[model samples]
Target: MTAVTAPEEVARIQGRVVRVLALGQVLGGVAFGATVSLGALLAADISGQESLSGFATASVTLGAALCAIPLARLAAARGRRTALTLGNLFALVGIAIVVTAAALRVFPLLLAGVVLIGAGNAGNLQSRFAATDLAAGERRGRDLGTVVWATTVGGVLGPLLLTPGEALGRLVGMPPLTGAYLFSIVAQAAALILYLVALRPDPLLLAQRISRDAAGGAAPPVDADRPLAARYAMFAVAASHVVMASVMAMTPVHLQHLAHAGHGGAAGANEAVTLLVGTTIALHVLGMYGLSPVFGWLADRWGRVAVVLLGQGVLACALLLATFGSDVQGIVIVALFLLGLGWSAATVAGAALLTESTPVDLRPRRQGIGDTLMTSSAAVGAVLAGVVLGQWGYGALALVALVLVALTTVLSPLARR
Candidate 1:
């Protein structure tokens, strides 16, 4: 097949790829968002120990970290289509297992299922990279951000489904929490089908072909700056993720406690808490994805390092607010929103930097490695956040997250040329 070189032709293909990927993101995000929102609550209920709550979210992050390299290798060998489809399949099976585990009240089974769910997240994360495969450098961040923004639709919708999901569970005789997984199952299956059917003429393969043809079958020259830039990108993404996950993992449990204390013995107390938590989570999800396009544009316009630094600053401010405002509901909401925004800034900019800095032939491997590090860091934070929250309180956990944010700031200078 002739390699596509015309700018218009490239734009056409890129547009199609972005549209398909965005749609898939929306569908897949519903499942992921629902699962994450419920993960800690489910774990706490199942284990009967507040300290073990983080394990649920941690398992998902750990699973994603473990699957990153393997999925990247698979993409390299087969194609994006196959790798993404397989990842979703893993999540589908996982949701089923999670439902069964919930029914049986088995904690270990729940953890195992969540891990596989994390594998699906690995695939979702990688899909953003696929959007950039055929994009010009100037538009790379924008295209990728558009795909990221697409997640907002389902991400927001998923948490909002909490009440309905619970009702459905009661109607069907399933555990209340397991009802959300019913939505997850359908959403994941839809995403799997979308990838298999819509992602044709895979972007990575086409980009490779174009690269080879443009170079007359010779390899592109290596840039000395790439290795350093890639390293910085990994650090920025990972640090930002750690702060977000650590705080987010414990927020539900914190809210649960408040609900018990403030509304105990009141009629519809459970429903009231569910509404509040679901809204908070939905808004958080919106903050994570809603403004990605703006961040993407800023990354391209101001440069990647600038965006990363800006994200670190935002995160620092967020942590401070959380630290002092733990008992204030409005303050906590704003802080979580800022937390999501900071994560978005760092992640979008960092990912674009990594893509531009890496050699085309080595892109998949490097991207995988970067994702592994990022998710692994978040997993550690998630696990520790539980202990910190249980022992010290949410204020202390936010302080710890603040330290990591500061470390990212210290590393920002290294990312500069």
Candidate 2:
């Protein structure tokens, strides 16, 4: 690879890289979506404590936070491919442990398994950044967004597999939620194989080589403003994620309560409740990933800061809806949708801004730091969400999320030069 400098060559490589990453994301997303859809329910069942439900999802986020630095360091030292492969392997192990734990009904084992599964999520999230590694500055957002958008396919389909997963579990003599993990295991394994085979010449390494060649084999000086901008981007992404995760983690429980109360009537009863919850989660995921390309385009055209602010506005509206319309099913659906959309916007914009602002040599580390902070914030929010929902109701949790969203909005202006 003789330092691919031609514009056409860069475009070609970027396209190829994006395609590979997108396909991998689809596979990984399916595995992640399936696991996450039932994570809380499974936790409640295994622990026999409704209050501990959020811990399942929180542990996943926590695992991601813990793995971020190590993965980033590995990417910096080895390559993105290696780091991602290792993450998937961790997830595979997690899936096995979760399956076994479910069979044995061990709560601690279940939590442990979920944490490792989160390592897989860490890899999936990092793939978006890898898409930008060889991209033209002008097209970075589009490339990144395209990869993000690819997740929509698997995300939407993952929840739909719930019934089938349960059936599969029964057929195999496994527990109810265990079937979803089986699907996850297969999906994750396929993703690992695809990445190992297809991602050649490593995008990050290639970009680094090109940079060295352009600078006559010398490294560029670090940008003084990059660190501050990165911090802003990190904060923006973290706040948005915290809001999304906090509300999303508890929505199933909320719906379950409504189901028990017969708010929607017991016409179809169990079947109706399952359909409602599954559809809501599916739509929420669609909102999270379906329109990523649009946000990406806006990020590239209108600018990253503008998009971050836009995401904050959407999030504020979502929080308000959740707070005021807590009793309405339609309102909750809309609120969750907006929550996902806001997250997509903020995440895409924040990630693009962070990538563009960071130094090449330091990009992986900064990206890791950003992800760690983002996921950890979400983890805390998730753990607290269970308590909040138990004590003050979903409305109060939304209000808390609103405050955080507002704080991000106030900080958005600082991200710009």
Q: TM-scores for all candidates?
A: 0.97, 0.96
Per-residue lDDT of 1-417 in model 1, one digit per residue for the tens?
Answer: 777766678788889999999999999879998888899999999999999999998999998999999999998878889889999988998888888888899999999999999988998888989988888888989998999999999999999998899999899899868787778888999999999999988988877777777656332333234788899899889989989988988998888777767787587777877787888889888989999999999999999999888888888888999999998877888888999999999999999999999867798999999999989888888999999999999989999888877888888777775
Which residue pairs clash within candidate 1? none
Q: Lowest summed-lDDT stretch of 10 residues in model 2? A: 216-225
TM-score quality measure for candidate 1:
0.97
Q: 110-152 in candidate 2: lDDT tens per residue? A: 9999999988788778899999888777788889999999999
